[model samples]
Target: MSAGDDGLVPDLGRGALTDRVRATVLGRRTPRAWFLALGLATLVSLLFLLGVVYVLSVGVGAFGLNIPVAWGFPIINTIWWIGIAHAGTLISAVLWLTRQDWRASISRSAEAMAMFAIVLAGSYPLLHLGRPWLAYYLLPYPNLMDLWPQWRSPLVWDFFAIASYLLFTASFLYLSLLPDLASLRDGARRRFQQLFYGVLALGWRNSARHWARYEQAHRVLAVIAAPIVVSVTGTISLDLAVSIVPGFHFTIFPPYFVAGALYSGFATVAIIAIILRGLFGFRDLITRAHLNRLGIMMLCFVLVVDYAYLQEIFTAFYTGEAFYRGVYFDRWTGPYAPYYWGMILCNVVLAQGLWFRRLRESVPGLLSLAVIADIGMWLERFQIVITSTHKDYMPSAWDTVRPTAWDWLTYAGSIGVFFVLLLLFIRLMPSVSMHDMRALLHRRREGGHG
Candidate 1:
């Protein structure tokens, strides 16, 4: 649906993606703003490289973890990053499969985040390994050591789960990009930009026939990716649930992890949107209306988390199970009480404010919530990782895992890395999916309700 499809109001509900997509991809506008985005993103990328070097040279031991708290920063970071990773394809592919047109603008960032988040997250499991080089042992291979990977282990499951997600996310990101790349290829004025996008376009002509086939294939891929994101993280949740651990071993783990993933993922998206809008001056694209839509979704996610947290506590203490009760007590009335309370305040108290219509729509308020929610989600993951391990069945093995400099730096560097990659994605690529947005807007112009 082009802008001319409908004689009536066109592109009204089409969202920011369609409004500015043509200018972005065709290089119709000036490049001064993009140059600035490139410079900032480059600086952040350099910092990320330095961080990786330090992490590799120093070894995983430089982070935190003793016998009981063996899974600390790396694991926690993995969960948080992976959670943030889910929203990309989850919203893009999943929602697209369900025919949610409002998701158009957010899908590009969502898909990109899935790629980088997995890249960043996939590193931690290897980094935390005793012999990082020997990490491939998790893969299932016959004729290898007589000792096969324990199918019962979550760590082993995570290897396949994350790997599958990374592949699917990469494929999904590329598929969505091809059309836009074609638009850039056909429209770019500069020789270098033409050459760059031309390769990605793969000799495509942006004919109506091509767009039709591409859109159909894209819809199919989204259908595949949506469930993959949900299932992948659910498997991760089982890594904790199937265990003998009290706070963990339950059917709720699947939904709990899924909800947490959305909670963290949407928050990360909001943070990215805020940055992209600020740096790129694409307030026309990543507008307040779009932010409001996502903010509301985030608001809902937090509520789901809060509800889940309550049920978790209720089941633990109310069930009369000694193990669950003990875990609950250890977290609530124990040394980790401060962190637990912080989680409650941040995740619950702040979330309740979204009940008011104004707060969800406010820029400053939504921005603050997005940043705070990220911190809250990180702590929530920490609560899951630390609380469970800190008060395990064996009291002798229980100990607090305080982070070292390496842990903090590595995590800090990842923050820089996400922004670094995101900033570049904004400059070099369309942060918003232009082709899809254009179609949706075109349909809207034609008076299509969707």
Candidate 2:
């Protein structure tokens, strides 16, 4: 193998690679760790369900919302989850289109992460709707009374953005899965397993014609997904950017949010890669080099985020607008100042560690940084949502909005929901892209790296 190929994959035959990945799903004995993790995730998901029921029975008033700070955990979580979803598309679609061989092993898991994250993202808006049952009102379906959605409302925009992104993500994931599902169907000894995979495979036979069509479809989707990736987050950012709110009305928000989203997204992919590697003993497939690449990407985006932070502050003072200047002042010295500083610490200070090669390649280092990056991104969203509106233009209306227990409960529960869905996804499907890995191996062999 060439030196450049080091830490991509281990020396293994095609059959060995296929067997290792397939065994994660098809093996008879479930791992004890998997059981434990699933149990914990399920418990948390139940908690989330309980929170949802309580909110529905009572109201969104169960949260820490006030007249000024009407947007609370719901909006914060929606933006955070949506941001996390970006990495999956970036990894699976952008990397594939670019022919980055390192993406082969991690792309499937990344896509799954994106899929679940977007689902969680989309759910928050419905929860935030005091009457979730009325969520359909956000849609533009014709009615007998001739009522229609307010096209100008951010809620309607979110509805379309999230729904479109979710559909695109699902199609991308299912399209990518067809070949692997066919492999699972062919390899399954049990009739039930065969039937399950066969139905999902959509009758994929791995013929040359099938491959040709698959390539064409996948490339087309990839081309479409790249723009969707930027547009979705930018649209979400416009929810704040289009507003008259001092801190929220920055022109830089679209690009700022995009960078922050990709930053957090790559960090999440890294965390998932590390967990998958540790749990499945995929040291050879998801190697240190992959972590290094992830860290580099994270570093790249966080740098952009840091620059945005500076630009935001500069734009505030440059305009010489008291409201904008006060927003920056409040962010630095207000009640939520701690969160703003913590975001700076995590996204700016600690993120600089990625510039060091040793730290980026170290499992513990990369994992710690990834977790920190996600937390930092959350803090960024938290401060942006809460601090912006908590003390608006009017001193008379300025009030503090502290999160109620229900707020924490709902937020934590959402995290649980995401994990539960992701765990089940990995257990049922191939965590790694089998066909992509095979193609990688084939290319490596042709290049004398096998």
Candidate 3:
């Protein structure tokens, strides 16, 4: 079947398609559901802020950290958020480079998701620092005292990785938005609206020169973004792998983490795509085909994750090292055994549902699987961070570390922060890319699949 036959972009005039997207931001009336969701998200974000204040005031002791298990929700959530962020780059940059038409409808939101998820991911390291104000110590700058950041510290590596990715994502997102922002600038009636978009549009004139330069710049950024996507997660994985902890010290971690990150990321994109379609009524633009493609992507990466899981176990046993074998045994029968099995069930077993074409194309089925995949990925991080550290070499030092109320609050609040930002973003800006959709329509008219 041809791409148009699958309804990537429904048969609509350029003006009609543009109007449908513009109306989401420029419409006279707003959706009640958006307001409700925003209000709830804002409340939770406030709670997240409150949690931050509590942590700053009371110290990182507010989290569930102990002797061996110094890493807690902050580290787990950081890795989880970073993994979630990967899909945005993959969808927006990698797929764009590969000339995937389906990415047009979703890339804008995916980029936005990447932007926010990285911010949240970057915030955790600061929160984990006992004295977050001293975070600048990680930055390599000449100071009066001539103090330099430890060059070998993984924490230093994380700072640079997150910072670099954040800059790249922001640039990538804004660059892609130039054409769409120009559209909003032209379509907006109010002076304030025009000025707001005009500044962001960066003087885009829709001229041939502007289009050529924009495409060149965007393609360059996409090329940079492809490697950034892999390296960011790989660096984060190194933060664990560099450690001698039995669960963390694996040569397979870099690729395993990369696959897991993309798996969670695509799952998040699926969730966001479903939410966007339902909230903004983009059912025709974002069709069952989009969901099916997302399902396929999720399945492909998750199978890699399932293989990595087995490889980890095999490596643990093959080494003939008591520590490595004991770690897996503990994972199976220790206090955190349930979490280990839960991750297995969600990621390895339940994820197999995507093999069925019926399930891949079912809205409810895809959404459920996506949510489960995210949960499983989170559980995977949870086990890697906590279970790995909780049981160290010294039997006397081995103790269970449970998340305190503050940990739950902070984790849930971070989620709230992400949704609140996303909700506000959709309300203010075009959630779908008007220009990209227009191009898709143009391709359909020319009887060529883009």
RMSD per candidate (Å) reads: 3.6, 1.6, 1.4
Candidate 3: tens digits of C-alpha lDDT, residues 1-450: 444777676767889999999999988788999999999998888878988999999999999999899988999999999999999999999999998989999999999999999999989989899898988888889899989989898878888999999999998888888898999999999999999999988888889888888888988998998899889999999999998888899999999999999999999999989999889899988888899999999999999999999999999999999988899999999999999999999999999999998998888999999999999999999999998898877778998988999998988899999999999898898999988888888777866543
Cα-based lDDT at residue 81, candidate 2: 98
Residue by residue across 160-252, what tens digits does model 2's lDDT show? 999999999999999999999999998999999999999999899999999999999999999998999899999999999888888999999
lDDT of 1 by residue, 1-450 (tens): 455232212234544444455455555554676567656656656655675676678765677788777888888888889888988877887777777666776778878877899888888888888568888688777855586899878878889999998888888888888988887776677898889999989987877788788878887887788778788888888878888876777778788888888888998888777766775566655667777778878888888888899899888888897878899888888877888888888899987766666776677888888877888888888888888987778877767777776677678877767766766676678787877777766666666653
Q: In terms of TM-score, which candidate is stronger, 1 or 2?
A: 2
Q: Distance from true position, residue 63, model 1, in Å?
A: 1.4
Enumerate clash totals for all models, in the order shown: 1, 0, 0
Q: Measured by C-alpha RMSD in angstroms, how accurate is candidate 3? A: 1.4
Off by over 4 Å in 1: 1-55, 142-147, 448-450
- lDDT, each prediction: 0.77, 0.91, 0.91
Q: Is candidate 1 or candidate 3 better by lDDT?
A: 3
**Candidate 2: segments with Cα more than 4 A from true spot:** 1-4, 447-450
lDDT minimum window of 10 residues, candidate 3: 1-10
User: Which order, best to worst by lDDT?
Assistant: 2, 3, 1
